[model samples]
Target: MQNKLLGVIDATTHKNGIEDLITNRSMSAIPFAGRYRLIDFVLSSMVNSGIESVAVFHGFQNRSLMDHLGSGREWDLNRKRDGLFFFPSPLKEPDSDQLGSFKQFKQNIDYFYRSDSQYALISNCHTVCNMDFESILQRHISTHSDITEIKHDGQSLEMYIIETSLLIDLVQNEETTGYRSIVDVVRDSRNTYKVSEYEYIGYAALINTIEKYYKYSLEIISPQIWKQLFLKDRPIYTKVKDEPPTRYNKGAVVKNSMIANGCVIEGHVENCILFRGVKIGKGTVVRNSVIMQKSQIGENCELDAVILDKDVKIENGVTIKGTETIPHVLRKGTIQGALMNS
Candidate 1:
């Protein structure tokens, strides 16, 4: 099922507000579910769909991306030919106007020219879903489309499967038009290029805003969504971690939560997602929240609709509450909680 396919994860753009939760990491590297990054969905979807080659364009804090993807072996992308490639942007550019996304593509035009794949699947690490791109590839071939992209509710997911030659032609023809981004090209291509759109039902969360992020993080609580995301045909792969099973002490109580490995729970957790290495001290009560890796929550604390970023420390007897619509967020590595004694 090669279909002469090549994948390009065009995730170099910045997503505002997500920086508030994590300052030193790219959005693609932000952990999701229990143990996966946002990029894991896109990369896994592609790899599960039989893509052998992928190129990730890094925007800022690329070190985080490098740390997560390492050798691409987790996704089975380490190959002698047509594996993974990293394209890094300079720390400082001459001007903002010169940093157009199309300009970035023009700089890396040799990659597309050098590849023998007939089709280029351009995607972003936004939508979190398990999907197979094979049907869309077949659709593109059957329709003889210059570009075939997926759309949900009349919105393109920024994942386009276009003919490689058409992409090269677009790059060559739109060199100096001050093109803003690839979306601009596709938006205007209806007139110049043959374009086809397929409806996609893969939107479990529109995570551009904090509210959406919080909302979608809890969507996994649903039996339908959980089965669709994890128990489906293709497995979502990520960097493996060797840790013992989550330990729930005699007094610990868990209800409707997804807790990962390396967690020690001695309190009560309800409707939450806990990443690895989290330690919930005795007598704490947490509800409707997402606590990331290595965070420590002291005893007698009460939290509702909160998102504690990785490595956060919450002291005892403190209370933090926010609505599910707009959950309170603690940035990465921030320490919260009152230094109080019972």
Candidate 2:
């Protein structure tokens, strides 16, 4: 029998809204390792697993997302039966603006249950990695887990410790001890006859659980409830692969660091997280900067920590450095200082 899987793309705010202020954009839309946006990883993974139906939950500041993923044809997700679907937050009134991330997510849950699919794969765009959901779904079936979470072990403690603590406190009672790490909380949350190893990759596999507990309940639920439902017993299993850890392209020379994509380089590059389609002019010495999509740098122009927004241009001999700690936000054009949206 063919199993229906839904890939839910969570295009939420970035860490406490810091990145959002700069770009006023969704994390999914954030420019990453050259030539690939953050949402590309999740969307590509779904396509790789033969999942054609996807619903991307887009909230605030999604114009760029709409522009980049127009019709979803590039990823082969544009189809009549199973293709990419955009689920934006419902407006309170006809004239009202978009809702927050959590509000949009709750609406997505409603959309998932209304569908004819059996399983749903909920993912956030913050993570960057490769995943095979077909294999993961098979494991979930064999284990009969109501909810399965995808997890990674190597994340820094400082990054995940507080979130893990909050999860434990919300899901478990006061008597629950030894909740030192996220692993401990996962171990305690299982409601099955036997425990299994399942890494919580901050992603989840829900089998009709959204309908059972959440349908007709409320438009929005607490994070605690979300965590409790996520931890529900069944047979949570982790699909760990010994693949080579992701690395930057060799030909691409990054001087100041912050390179993300699997980019291939043929020319010299310095100090930039060159988001995909960023072509460097030969002998271009880009110092301390972020260059967004398809921006071309002229040869010998020195850029220091400059935030070049989408489709920006820099003429040769243009030196923009030491403006401020925060890089100058340059929209489309050959800019020298800051270009604020007016």
Candidate 3:
């Protein structure tokens, strides 16, 4: 089933609720869990499931997304033959609400026709889970279904498994069928397609909003949930960064925080996740926050329930606080000085 299945990742969805972080990037490129992007979970899962010849369909403002997935080398997908393929759509305004947009798929329909895979696994980019697609494919074949949608806890995870030929037909006759996407074909009962469900009882979270992102980001700090998402066998792959070990200077106090490499810490931190190359100055207290790559916090600042994007610098003596329901988001490359304290 591995070699017979093709992987399709839709990276064009743009969520209004996550606008602060994704204004300059795709939702898939958003940083998560200290060192991984949001797309890492799903992409790595596909690789682990032995699915080669994956294609990513992205939209504009895909610089970071393309950069993160360069040559797909990190995922062992930089093959000479059937490897990673990227398709950049020309549309500016996308149907951000839906998972599988047939219009976007139709733009690059030739790729589907050229591939020799018998089945195609279509997925959205925002879901975080360590799934095994081979198992799903086995079930789809056994049931003789036209389309199989993956569900978790009775809710759709926006993932589907369908035959490559059928998907191509749907894309070609979308106008005549009046079906906008694979989602539409599943929702409307007029079609003769046999839609099946595969219930997945695992750690799955769909992050389309800042609230869900913040909630799930912090929730993975628990050791139990961490183990479920990250397994030694099914490792989640990301762009490898060569950096020195984190440095905790004198008087640095940290508890229950996950800090990545190349970080210099001299502050009192608790319940925080700091990404690579971050710096926490002396006398600062950060609690229940997520600091992304290359961000620095000055001395004597107090941060709680906040998310600092990449390259952000917080000046000394600034205090910022947000409730768990609404996290304070500092955009990418922002420098928050004393004048901008809240």
Candidate 4:
């Protein structure tokens, strides 16, 4: 079954609602769950499903995505055989930035043509789930369906399993057929293809907007939610950073937070998720926030319901607060000081 299936991940779509966090990175590379990127969940699922050859199609803002998925070593896809392949879209402006984009796929049609796989598992990079594509493939085969769309609670997860030949055919004749993407083909009533849906009962979160991102990030703080996403046998893989254990200094009071490695906490943190190498200075109080990698919060500062990007520095006595619905977002490399706020 592994030899008969190929993995294709679409990482090019950009959401206007998520613009704040994606200013310097693609949606797929957005930091999540303390140490992993949004793409890690889907990519790891493909690898865990025994799909050896995987291709990631990305857009212009691909520096961070490329850097994070360099050779796909962390996912054990760095091999001499048919391993991880990356294809950047040639279009400076695509006709449409949708999942299973045929425009981008048309740019690298040779990849689909040359593969020996019988079927393809196409997925979006931003969906957070620990899925087994093999199960979907089995159902597709048993049902004799042309396209199998995976859904969670009757909502589309934007994942599909289709024959490789049919996928190539759709990409090749997209203009003639007037089909922009897999969604278009599936929606068309004139098509003879048998479309099916496989209900996914597991925990799945699609991080497409700021609200959903913030909601899911905090939701995973619960052990029950994180347990569903991170399985013992099928673990999500990410670029490993060798960092020392997190240190909780004297006077630090943390409750219900998830802190990654190489962190130094001397402040009070409650219901926050701190990524790798974050520093909470003495006398600070942080609550219900998602702080990314290497961000430093200064002494006596207070942050609530905020999302700080990587390398953000909150200076002494800075007080920033926002609601859960519209959390304050500090872009990457930005420094917020008390004087700035005053």
Candidate 5:
């Protein structure tokens, strides 16, 4: 059978209660890695996988996403039959309370089911990774799993892991031999067993599962209970990443850093996460900072613990060592020794 249609949910939002302040802006659109945006990872992966159709669910602050992913021309997602689509959040809902991420996803259920495709691939844009979906689809078909959860290494301890076999059984409702709560499956080793399939990489696979069994609103459905019901019995599959993981470029000198794409550095950097399109002049020193997109730092400027917002400019001979414990936030401009957060 032809591979199912693919749907990608940008699911990124500004911190709640701050949406009005940053209207039409999405967290996914936030610039990252030097020159690349965060959504690029997901979009690129989808494009590379030969999945032609993609829909980006924009919640708020989506202008950046719209700007960067314009018409999906760059990734060749602008096809006549299967191309990139932008799904804006519905402005008029009968019940405004259904505004959370889960609810927003639930509202888009029609898009997933209405598609002529047989399978669905769902993912978020918060992570950056290289994935070959052809292999994943092969594994999914061979295993005949209802749901496939992708997991990556280096996740925090707070994350949870579920076995594929157990997940399949739970979703099929074949685990119950007597009266028991769904959580009991986790406790009962005999009924629930582990299978090495794909780890849950915060992404999920649904083989028409949602279209088949979804009844109640996503807001009312408890995630724990849902996991217990479907995931407890369903046979979950795993896909281990055997290839060498990708890392930052070696020519890039990042210190105490969280660096993203589209960056070129030939200077000394310490304690910074430089976003995309950030350029550090040679012979410059940056310490304890968070620099946003397209920002430039002149040579020989010593910056200590500063948070430079997008498009900020720092001129040469500007020594910015502040006494405040909290790093100063520098707006867009050329400055010297400007006290941030003052």
Candidate 6:
């Protein structure tokens, strides 16, 4: 990616079937891998590739998204010139609904105009992968394509690079009802425009539902995938937490787990992802679970194949178990005991 290339991230839409995790925040803000949000993967990829000018379009309950991406300084996106720009929701009418990226982009066309970039890289924040967008941009420029899309598993990552003029034309005339989405415009214009495809030979993912989320979360636990995504040459950056390292008490027994900082373990955790400030009380058992930030599990509690959202509290004497394909989910700030099924 060159300095002339600008990045645009779609963080406005709501992802269905993930209501439990995305009720209060955009899907991009969803926590992942103990210490990272889904957006970090994409943002880091762009920043690592030397693309400084970036815009994150946000809506549908975006306070957490705002807090998480303050100033974009962490990713080195806060700069003198083309730096991080956030386009907030513009649907302020009484009857207007929550905004989406297309509308947000249309309203903020001045950002694109003043950017002076010849090309733009557009992507959704849901896919969790570490990719070199420079390759994608090179292919787009070499092929002289109007739009070059990256695909994996027969579906577009919703990642594309387009000539800025073509994007302007498509978006400027998007007054009709049928062409609200970028996909729709690209599809409808295929006959008139030159569209190309580049297969991504990396760990491309689509985590839309809870089951898929749980499945992918566990899949990354594989050392190969973990190394490829997080520990590669270009590191994945996130908000720095200056907490101390995790502490394991005398009775602690952890195996095949990824534990982050600010955790205290006195029980057993197997094949789990423990985020910052999580506490596993003595005698508690966690297997095949993902416990997010600041959650606590009381003693004698047993959790298997579960996804506990942030700030959840599980009392003692509870055993919550679900199958591998369909893990039970406890929503954010939930308090659970023996009777609660969530």
In order, candidate lDDTs are: 0.80, 0.51, 0.93, 0.92, 0.51, 0.84
lDDT of 6 by residue, 292-339 (tens): 999999998889999999999998878899889999998899999767
Alpha-carbon lDDT of model 1: 0.80
TM-score, cand. 2 vs. native = 0.56
The positional error of residue 27 in candidate 4, measured at the CA in angstroms, is 0.6
Q: Which stretches in model 4 have alpha-carbon errors above 4 Å?
A: 94-97
Q: Is candidate 4 or candidate 5 better by TM-score?
A: 4
The list of candidate 5 runs beyond 4 A from truth reads 14-24, 91-102, 105-110, 154-197, 200-284, 287-290, 296-300, 305-307, 315-342
TM-score of each: 0.93, 0.56, 0.98, 0.97, 0.56, 0.94
Better of 1 and 2 by lDDT: 1
List model 5 lDDT by residue over 1-342, tens digit each.
Answer: 366546554444334422221333454554433345546655666666666778787765566678777887777777887788877765432221221233344456565545666655556654444455656666766776544445555331111123223322343443345412223333355743342246534332221111111111121134443353233222221111133222334444665555655666867887566766677876778876667766888776787766666777877667765433444555544354434312
Deviation in angstroms for 53 in model 4?
0.7
What's model 4's TM-score? Answer: 0.97
Task: Give a tens-digit lDDT track for model 1, residues 177-261.
Answer: 5455557766774466678898887644545567777888888877878887884568998998899999999899999999999
Quantify how close model 4 is to the true structure by its C-alpha RMSD in Å: 1.3
Q: How accurate is candidate 5 locally (lDDT)?
A: 0.51
The candidate maximizing lDDT is 3
Error of 1 at 108 (Å): 1.6
Give the lDDT of residue 260 in candidate 1. Answer: 97
Candidate 6: TM-score? 0.94
Give the winner by TM-score: 3
How well does candidate 5 score on lDDT at residue 205? 22
Stretches > 4 Å off in candidate 6: 1-3, 91-101, 176-178, 339-342
lDDT of 2 by residue, 1-342 (tens): 267666666554345323422255665665543345556756776777666777786666788788878887777777877688888755332111111233344444555545666766656654544556777777766886554556557432111111222232323432355333233334465433233334546433221111211111121133443353223332111211233322434454555444434333434665456655565655557665666656766666666656676677676656676443344556544444223211
